[model samples]
Target: MRINVLQHTPNEGPGSIATWAELHGHALFTYHPYQFGQLPTAVETDMLIILGGPMSPNDDLPWIKAERVLIQDLLARDVPMFGACYGAQQITKALGYPVSKAPTKEVGWVPVYRQSSVIPNLPDNLNVLHWHEEMFEIPTEATWLFASAAVRNQGFVLNHRVVGLQFHVEPRQNNVREMVVNDFPYIKGSVLNQTAEDILRVTVSGKNERALFAILDYIIE
Candidate 1:
């Protein structure tokens, strides 16, 4: 299978998802919008994976708008998609919703409460990496999958093909380190936010990693 990964930044590449694609013998075509100008076409990829970023979906960047247009085009084609953090917001925006600022930043290892029965073998509470200040509401036709105390719209699934996750379940240890290093200004002592030291100290447990793969499997299958 061919998977096109839309990366918003150099640091937030497809972490565990890249490992999955490599191990499963799937082709990976990555586009770094920060460096590269254009997004991928649906005809070129069997699946689309949008990774996280520091920018909001509501940003005034030209690429951001183009990415949303690409998303809508892909959805029209019924291509399977998985989005994380800022990517989730992009999907929500493409679905005709507004991405707005949250009450506070959710930046650390946080628990996301499951809400939908769409995802099989899901835990009631999922511990994942949260690193965003913006959130989006579940789109009109999408099923709400996860939520947290800090944010109500943590995840959503549409037609079992398109999925959006507000947290970073696909992050590896190195991915976390790079994100912390690049966005250290957002770290602070708060209810949801965690310090760089604490963020680095927490190991990437196997459970969250498995959950991420499971979600990916479900979306593609």
Candidate 2:
């Protein structure tokens, strides 16, 4: 399968998704919307993986508008899509759903609970990176898949084809540390409420990455 990746930044590129794509023999391609690029003309892709970003879904960015249309068209055509954080918000918003500031910004490794779905076949609580200020509404046509203790709407699936996850299931440790160094400035005001030491403790739980990829693999399958 050819998996197209819509990247929002350089560091938060593909992470485990790239790993999985390579190991599984799926051809990988990328579109950096931050650079105002076009979606691939190739339709050979079996899945579309939209990565996370620092920008909110409501941002007036040009790529945001273009990708919104692209995602909607993909969904309409019944193509498989899996979005993370901002990507998930974009999916929900494109479907006429709403996204807004979450009361508590989930930052470190937090457990996401499975709702009424086959996801319960996995662990009861899998720790994930929560780095978004905005949350998405479960599309009226979608079914809730998972939730976290801090946030109720962690993820949802529409017609079992499109899946959106609010948490970062595939975070690379170095990229996260770098994010804390560079992108941290933008989230500093609200993120500072939690100590850097505490964030480190939770995020460094390396075992979470396995479960994260497992979930992603399951979702894509």
Off by over 4 Å in 2: 42-44, 187-192, 203-207
Error of 1 at 164 (Å): 0.4
Kindly give the stretch of ten consecutive residues in candidate 1 with the minimal lDDT sum.
Answer: 185-194
Q: Per-residue alpha-carbon lDDT of model 2 for 126-206, expressed as tens digits?
A: 667778778999988888878986678998878767888898877677766766666655555454365455565554455
**How far off is residue 110 in model 1, in Å?**
1.3
What's model 2's lDDT at 38? 67
> What overall lDDT, based on C-alpha atoms, would model 1 receive against the true structure?
0.87
Model 1 CA deviation exceeding 4 Å by range: none
True lDDT of residue 58, candidate 2: 95
CA RMSD of each candidate after superposition? 1.3, 2.3
* Clashes, model 2: 0
Compared with the true structure, model 1 gives a TM-score of 0.95
- Expressed as tens digits, the lDDT of each residue in 1-221 for candidate 1 is 99999998887888899888988899999998867787887688799998888788888999989999889999998999999999998999999999998777788888899998788977888788888888888988999999989788899999989999998898889988998898878776446656889888999887787888888889888
Model 1 RMSD in angstroms:
1.3
Quote each prediction's TM-score.
0.95, 0.88
